[model samples]
Target: MEASPQYTLTERGPLRAALKTARPQEWVKNVLVFAGVIFSGQLDDTWAIGQALITFACFCAISSAGYFINDLNDVELDRQHPKKRFRPIAAGQLPISAAWVISAVLAVGAIAV
Candidate 1:
């Protein structure tokens, strides 16, 4: 029988691991929320600009939450993949329990925003 591959914990700190898991680079996509205000020519409206910024922030949080959840779910599978094996969860840099907690906090915070 083939044995399961052993995974060793990486030396990366928890905060760095967590940030990598959150995938901030993906957050840039959330900036599209401002398109509505820009397209409507409301750039001069402080309230509209404020709302757009808030929406963008909320989307960023929610998207990061989704990423955490996805990584948690796919961790085992990711560990088997050549490229995905480097992911924080897959590589054991971020604890599954901590990922769950971070996901929950981000999701709730986004909703509260």
Candidate 2:
């Protein structure tokens, strides 16, 4: 039998891992933030549109931060899942300390926005 290739963490650079940790693909869900404006019939109001956009941005940042924190807490369990094992923290591509720092920054940004 042939041995499968082994990865020793840090497969990608910190920037790439950080981006993956952010999980931009999930941003599509933020579109729901615009529903408030649409339902209120304020689509033509620049202020409402701007508010919705800002809300969407904040939601994305906060949710991304939450995801990072959740991943940090579930690193060990995630390692047992075939797919989740490749997540930045679970796979050891991103350090727990760094994840905490990144998540804090993102959370603060979300609050500020």
Candidate 3:
């Protein structure tokens, strides 16, 4: 059995790749979680703000998990595409098995929260 290739910081730092996997730019959509409190006139309440923040964080985690799963499912297909081939998983910057673990962890975190 052969071992899979590993990516080092020189090639592509795992941390950077993981962060990219999370798709931080899309986190802006989580802001909608606060809309309920904001439009309902509960924005001034500390408890409501706290809840909304928690909800936003959970949603972010869930969304990231979704991205991980999507990437895992598309890794091979992505490798065939010029642009998508550069993605962390398809580029071999991140491992597919690790992505599965991360996706499960994020999903559990979202559910627990």
Candidate 4:
């Protein structure tokens, strides 16, 4: 029989936490950037659409990466705050080191773009 995919419980928490921090719901805000280009009659231009898409994606990832970094840096303080205490890092649901690693990788990806 083929082996099942391997992933530790610790690994799953970080992956899930990272996705949560990315806030997919807020990606709708990025449509505004495309709308601006389209309203300007730039929609017919493929290069414009492609570039805008890349920028939009990069910025979204960067925003999430920044959030992760902030969480790691403020974990202690967040634990003291009423609402923030429920955050992944602050709640100890996600490791601070893992958050930093994800943030660093995202930051580099954005810079290269």
TM-score list, all predictions? 0.85, 0.81, 0.87, 0.79
lDDT of each: 0.91, 0.90, 0.91, 0.79
Model 2 regions lying over 4 Å from their true place: 1-11
lDDT of 2 at 96: 89
TM-score of 1: 0.85
lDDT of 4 at 89: 84
Please, what are the lDDT tens digits per residue for candidate 4 over residues 1-113? 99875655467566666776656677777676687678889978999999899989887878778888888888889999999998888888677777788888888898789
Candidate 1: worst-modelled 10 consecutive residues by lDDT: 4-13
Steric collisions counted per model: 0, 0, 0, 0
lDDT for model 4, please: 0.79
Backbone clashes in model 1, listed as residue pairs? none
Cα lDDT, model 2, residue 25: 96
User: Once superposed on the true structure, which residue ranges of model 1 sit more than 4 Å away at CA?
Assistant: 1-11
Best by TM-score: 3
lDDT of 3 by residue, 28-113 (tens): 98999999998999978999999999999999999999999999999999999989999999999888888899999999999997
Ranking by TM-score: 3, 1, 2, 4
- Residue-wise lDDT of candidate 1 within 36-56, one digit each (tens)? 999999999999999999998
The alpha-carbon deviation from the true structure for residue 4 of candidate 4, after best TM-score superposition, in angstroms, is 11
